[model samples]
Target: MFKTLADWLAFDVFGLTAESSMGESVHFFIMDITKIFFMLVTIIYIMGLFRSFVSPEKVRTYIQGKSKFAARVLAIVLGAVTPFCSCSSVPLFIGFVEAGIPLGVTFSFLIASPMINEIAVVMLWGMVGWKITALYVASGMVVAFFGGIIMEKFKPERWVEDYVWKIQMGEVQAIEQDNSLPARHRYAFGEVKEIVGRIWKWVIVGVGLGALFHGYFPENWAASLGDANNWLAVPMSVLIGVPLYSNAVGVIPLAEAMLLKGVALGTTLSFMMSIAAISLPELLILRKVIQWQALALFTAIVTVSIMLVGWFFNIIV
Candidate 1:
């Protein structure tokens, strides 16, 4: 009975034949669907752990009276750890303002939090090489740091909400823990459900985008991008990626597909970083934090940094 059941479980339900084109199409569709589901479950679950475990409020207190440079460095480190989203960015921005951190320093944390979190790094490492993955983290942090500095030079105090100046200082609330084993388990499960539930749509969208690139795009895309022939790919890719927004997990599959399709590594990396850092989603969300002028400065700084990253990576790799 055990042997028979094992055989049954191993059998393909759709009866796709290995040698047939029709069977191959079915298999591809099934695999893409599975990947989409996996991306949703994995990405959001990780974010849930971040929400439940890490506290950005704690970070806000430490930057008090510190050098902007130090805060920027800390921002990069914090950004790597915190699981902030578009919704959360505002409160954090408010917290920074209430704390009297430099304008640029505040921008540093705000910029870093959503663009390059730990979840993205882990996903990048899993999907791409450690070298490329490391580059993503390092460059993202630098972008956040300098991007904030550039924004500070403009000094858009008018962009801040009038109410932020009146906010009284207070400690941030920490996550609650349960003493009972069952309750602890429930808390963990709840985190997963909450995180995954929110961004699951993005999973389907991202994987679907990746699948399109995988199935239909020219096979030589990455290779052509990878080749050092034209210097034009760097700026062109950056120009294209600016209005797009993708979390690291979403972009990893796209990057894999691009690489498979002969997309240039530098160009692809630039595109991924631009979408992650300087995209429309971030801009729209940032509008709630700072006015249009500041937002433009922020975008310009991030775009230039990403463009440089693309060119630098292309030259080195």
Candidate 2:
């Protein structure tokens, strides 16, 4: 059954009969649509659940201690398992700062949550190897933790707008006004609404781009990027990816397409990491909440970290 379906959805004229190509193209398109539909619904349901049980208040109460470095590390580990966006983490960021959790610690969570999200890592595991995926996740956490540490040491509180400080110190009233619903339903809806709202557009765009790549990328793209003698794929891809931002699920199809087209593993990985971790959206949004210096520092740190990750995997994988 699976073989038949694969044949129906992924036919190549050179590899299969004409009848199979027509059937497979239709099948592949349908599968793509189906994946998007289900993923959206699931994200909504999960986001709602998250809204019910967790909040800035709760997170603030828990994020304390002399072991801040360890705390930051823990946040990264836990964050990678979570499926949330960089914007949605604002509340937690506020909560941490309010709770006296320290600046670096808060940044740690912010960094890890968006960059090393579950969707990205899971996709990587399916497309790459466990070792590469593990490294990706690990490096993301380190970027957040170390980035936060560096920012904290520099003390960018002066750079933060007075408005963010005000919002951080107290209730963000806007997110709170909808307290009329039942707790369970409210939490579930909150999770879905917040997560889905932020990621939905990116998913659509990313998925469409990915599907295009999957369907049409020429062969030999990988060899061009992966050839060890050409070490620029990692940094070059990262630079190119800075303007783009797409979630893991949205980009996976593209990654698969790139592989099929012959894009180097190192270049592809770097590109994906840049899209996931260092996109223009993240930076622009972050500017509203953080100072220019902190934002620049954050971008620089993550960029270096991703490049390093790319280089390391290039050699090993």
lDDT of each: 0.70, 0.65
> Number of the top candidate by TM-score?
1
Q: Mark the regions of model 1 whose C-alpha exceeds 4 Å error after superposition.
A: 1-52, 170-176, 220-223
Report the lDDT tens digits of candidate 1 across residue range 1-317.
Answer: 33233233323665645455444334433554464455556665545544454476777777778877787888778777877767777777778788887878877776677667766676667566688888878887878878888788888687876777887866666656655656655665786687666755655566667756766565566556667566788888888888766665666667766766777677888888887776576677768767888888777888888888778877887
TM-score of 1: 0.83
Question: Model 2 reaches what TM-score against the true structure?
Answer: 0.75
lDDT (C-alpha) at residue 46 in model 2? 55
Q: Which residue pairs of candidate 1 clash?
A: 221-261, 221-262, 221-263, 222-261, 222-262, 222-263, 223-262, 225-264, 226-264
Relative to the true structure, candidate 1 has a C-alpha RMSD (angstroms) of 4.4
Cα shift from native, residue 195, model 2 (Å): 4.8
Across 125-191, the per-residue lDDT of candidate 2 in tens digits comes to 7555697677666666666777778767778777766776675365445355355457757666666
Top lDDT model: 1
